[model samples]
Target chain A: MGPQHPSTHGVLRVILKLDGEWIVEAHPDIGYLHRSFEKMGELRTYTNGLPLTDRWDYLCAMTNNLVYSMAVEQLLEVEVPERAQYLRVIVCELNRIASHLVFIGTYGLDLGAQTPFLYCFRDRERILHIFEEICGARLTYSYIYPGGVSGDALPGWLEKVDAFLDYLPPMMREIDQLLTGNEIFILRTRNIGLISPEQAIDWSLSGPMLRASNVNFDLRKESPYQVYDRLDFSVAVAEQGDCLARYHVRVAEIGESIKMVKQCLAQIPDGPTRAKLPKTIKPPAGEVYARVDTPRGELGVYMISDGTDKPYRQKIRGPAFVNLSILSELLPGWKIADAVSILGSIDVVMGEVDR
Target chain B: MSEEEKLENTETSDKPLKPAGKASPGKALAEVTPPDPRLLALAELLQSTFGDAALESVVDRGMVTLVISPGTLLDTCQQLKTDPALSFDYLACLTSIDRQDHLEVAYNLRSLTHKHEFCLKVRLPRDTPEIPTVTSIWKGANWHEREAYDLMGIHFQGHPDLRRILLPDEWEGHPLRKYYVYEPDDVPSEQGPPEHLLIQLEGVE
Candidate 1:
């Protein structure tokens, strides 16, 4: 119903074929913001393509940046310094918290709870400020470079992050009380949008959506990368596979991410944040696939290089694009009010979906 | 003569030679695991079953890739999903590449139960690019196949609804193709999409 609906989140339209309150067939119309980033990547040097990734999934720029850069790193066969890996873990988890907060806030709005939105954004503001301090920009910080992060956290950033960590739990409790534990919210979401585990995998669902169906696969844990192999965290999972379960998985993940961030802060060593490299990134001729668990799902970069500074072809395996495609399958039996909830629960950023 | 000399002497020549530096412990840990044995066995199984359909099985840098005949894309996909040993229920990605000489459709597959992944590529001639759809096997392939059709103009033979998912319905050319040239002033060139004729093209139902 929106290239511009309040709950559609970004530029998307769904043409619903309906029988009164029930959906007969739901056809999602996307790609309104198609920038052809893949084609643009072909024209630019490998290093220049990093900035464009910031726009791919604006919510978790660090995660998106790291995924693309990791693909290039695999092709180049370069190693990220130990400290850089730690920095990546720190920033990515922080970004994950920020992204999940946005999801919870906007989702509350979608389900008709307004006060939780204010509480979420209020906490989310501290994250953006912290990000701005680290990378000089919020939202689309192109800080995660090919070899490593653009720069290390400023002098007192860790202490500031620690303070935020202490401040986060009570806020989490507040949001839970306001929305998660609210009777109305439970009535609307608990069993309304149930997806069986078979449907989850057969439709190739991932992240919270897949985990909600009780699939325990997480790329960070399953196929660990960077310093993730050393990190202590558990993948969040739920059995119901409802809108409530998706919400629960993400909320639980926020607590897990905070734990990982604290671990990085405690164990991070002082060292060079970037590796030595030539002015241009000219990876050898090869194709590599790398993926990271973004707040939404598996964000992968499939790149093919022709032993040149410019990539021959690049493909972004955007989780939002794939996750949103399941709408047609999931939406047919549900009522119209549930449409916004289901779509919001998928947690898509259209920038990635349309890219 | 020194500590370096003794270490160098111990380093085997067969090891693909670490590229010019000491790998960090993390980098060493990330050393590409050897190709999945399950996938390798699956390749042998496919080769033994469909000798002609299975064209090649390649293991590059620990990634298992299978090149199969395009005519058997649908059949191969079906077997990959249902076969209990290689229960590749998760279709990670399905995209077509315009590799100048030919169009190649690559299916990056994953199985949760088996915890393995496989890549299947089907090469198609540039002019008459057609491959049977795998929507019956994994419903997720619906949009992926539609996207391949939309961006690369690779027709999916039996996709339920293979309309242009991303591009405009009346868009002249598949912008992703290597040959697609964006001429701002000219709507159609001698070789470009027949823009004028495509106006009357209806959405494929």
Candidate 2:
């Protein structure tokens, strides 16, 4: 429905075979915004590719940068400073909240609730303000470099972010009370787009979508990377794999991110924000992979370098691309109105899907 | 000290007893569940199940990667997914790499039950790259195989709907290969990319 429509998020075109209100088959024809980011990554130097990562998933650019930088760091065997790792976790968790807030707001819009949309965006604006203060840019913040973040957190930035952590829960509760208990929202979402746990695993669904179906596999909890091992948080899971269950998973995650942010604020040590990097940063001849738990799912980068400034090949295993692939399976036999709820529940950003 | 005493004291973890050359030296991965040291055990288990079907295996950066014969790719993956001890139900990521000498397809599989992972790779000839599709085992390989076919031009023999995914249907060349040269379409291709994509490709040699 949308290579141009608002609900599909970005330039994603889905071809639906339907009989009057019943969807027969649906295929998402993506790649309308294909920038050839991997080809560009192959052409650019190791560190020059950071900004390009920012463009793939604009909603969670920090996680993109974190994944790519960890890939290069694994190849080069350079250690990131303790403070930079802490900062990476902080910014990534903040972007997770911002990205999920967008999902809640837009999913509310899809289900025909306009007031919750305003509430979600009102909270998201504050997160963007904190990002703007840390880096100069808001939407595409290329603040995270290969070795470390571009700069240290400003003197008052941590406290402001801590205040934000406290500020979001009550509003999130407002969102929950307004949307979660709404009878119509339940009528639209419950049992409408159900994906079984076996189906979710075999179909390679991840993040909240997989967890919603009672799978206990989170990359943060299972394969903890970058200071995630130090932080303690529970993986939010739901037994029913429905559109409403997806909402419940993200809502629970917002609270967990707040707890993790509080821990980082109290324990973050004072030190240099970046590590020592060589002038011409060329990783040795080998391949390394690194993955992180982004707001969407596992955002992984597989890079092979042949002792040169440029990468031999860089493949971004984007979570949105794989997560969106299962729409055809979940969309059959549902009414056309349920299509919006189903697709929006997947929360795909076409930027990453197309890339 | 007795010989039995020395053998018992070594270590009971899943780590390989042979001390194979897979993980790079001196890189200790202590985070998260102490980085499972049982890489060699997984390799031996696979070898025990399928004798010569498992070709050569290596460890790079603490990841246990096994290179399987192209002919046995389907059977190896089928067993890896269904086996009770090694049920790798999750297909995390799949893509092909062009090594200029030959083409290699990589499959990263993980077991939610066992909490272990395996990297299965198959090398096909550069000229005619074809392998059996694992879609019948895990449906996630459907789009991944299509992407590999679209960008890298690796043919999945049994993939039900093998179509170009990221690029348009009428595009000329597979652009991911090192020596891939794009021949312009007579009618400015179906969703033609913008002019800014032009590259000299001059100094790439």
Candidate 3:
């Protein structure tokens, strides 16, 4: 049994009570990285808080931006320009692909396979480059504004993005060959972390986790937002509700996001990317909730405004937070090695989890 | 696909429950239920069951907000989940707001069976911010409630293993609260090792 260790990601100190190399009980001691990001939002002006949202889910900054912006927009009763909506769709889908790539790479590394990790990051770099082109920075691009995007897409950037999209399929094929069909990979993942559909629903699991359990509930499909209503895609679901099933769902989702991006690029119209927002943004006295399907799950934002520049209260509904709730239920009775695999299957980023 | 099978699915598995007293006498006898009217029925049922406990307020541009009290939180959630007419089986999200004056808890509940959603809120005072845990009903509420407690200093009673989730155990102050002060300390820096330091002539000079 491992003692409480610091480098296990986040401040997650787990005392694993093991018997003969098998985990008997895993007691997780968290709260090492807890920043009250929710309470902080209530203190800052609506615009100032967008950057903080970027920090929460650093991997999928676009989704966080969209969720928070949507909430603020709801409070202010402002409609973003259609062009801005299209831009959001494109960036979000790109972010989804990047996040899925990290998921694939990290899951491989967790299971003692290193080659796929490198291969996945090779693709991730290209996505990061595209993001850098859109916004000057790379890691936490706080580009999505409340009324619209920060600025217009750079000159000839669309052509470069098209080139990237064109080459993504062959790279994805290489990833599949390297990990998906390998016998060892299948054995490690197939039935390792089994949770039933009912269990998933009861736990409020969303995104790939819930889809892996065969509940076809994608917010993109069930509650279409932005340009999702017009996009053609499928909510990838599987009945296994195991590690392998979760992996497959995420893989399939990568393909669907690629498809959505293609359609968005093709149908993107020429118009002003932002609306005429007021200088000092003050929303009416009311509450609003907005949800966007992040790579992890449904990233929701709820804001209460008391007719002021700052919010009365802002609550960020992080998908990782809810998804991690089921970990205690899943870890016991499984081998310690399987615990890492299951954690990977849930696809938690401590930034969002600990936020 | 048989008539009997279709009838059974509609009667037992699909349809939402009928609200007592609210259902008209003539319609109550007829019992003609529509497909997946659970969310609609739930709104009506909640209004009648816990009259003032279920407070509906529009936030922003007509976005529905239903304020629920702490005491009836568990029963309200269970009814939304188990009742076929109002099966809000999926707790999409659970989060909290730290008002220096008061702590606000929000639950985003969705019906996977019916494809509908609604928000539930409960406010607790800052001096004694405590609310019942809904982990018994949704299980997803466990981490969320802990997060609230961790960040906003709200206590979630009956949480199986309630402790600091996002912040360190030894770490002082909740960073999320408005009144949390960020005061820097006056500790002096440790001196560098003498062997590694640059030479300076003092007594010899």
Residue A140 of model 2, lDDT score: 89
On the 0 to 100 scale, the lDDT of residue A180 in model 2 is 93
Assess each model's interface with DockQ, reporting 2 decimals per model. 0.24, 0.24, 0.24
Per-residue C-alpha lDDT of model 1 across residues B5-47, encoded as one tens digit per residue: 2243234111222321343453344343233344467667656
Write down the TM-score of model 3's second chain: 0.65
Candidate 3 chain A, poorest ten consecutive residues by summed lDDT: A1-10
Q: After superposition, which runs of candidate 3 have C-alpha atoms over 4 Å from their true positions?
A: A1-11, B1-45, B52-62, B98-102, B125-127, B170-205
Candidate 2 segments exceeding 4 Å error: B1-36, B47-51, B182-205
* TM-score on alpha carbons, each prediction: 0.89, 0.90, 0.85
Better of 1 and 3 by DockQ: 3
Pairs in steric clash, model 1: A2-A12
Report residue A194 deviation for candidate 1 (angstroms). 1.3
Put down candidate 2 lDDT per residue, A257-278, tens digits, no spaces.
9899888887687777777777
- TM-score of predicted structure 2: 0.90
What clash pairs does model 3 have? A31-B165, A31-B167, A31-B168, A33-B166, A34-B166, A34-B167, B16-B84, B16-B85, B17-B85
lDDT of 1 by residue, A1-355 (tens): 8889989998999999999999899999998999889888988998889899999999999998999888877776566767888899889999999999999999999999999999999999999999999989988888888877899888999999999999999999989899988988888888877889989888888889899988898988877788776678999999999999999999999999999999888878777787666688887686777889999999878788898899988888889898898898899999999998899899999999999
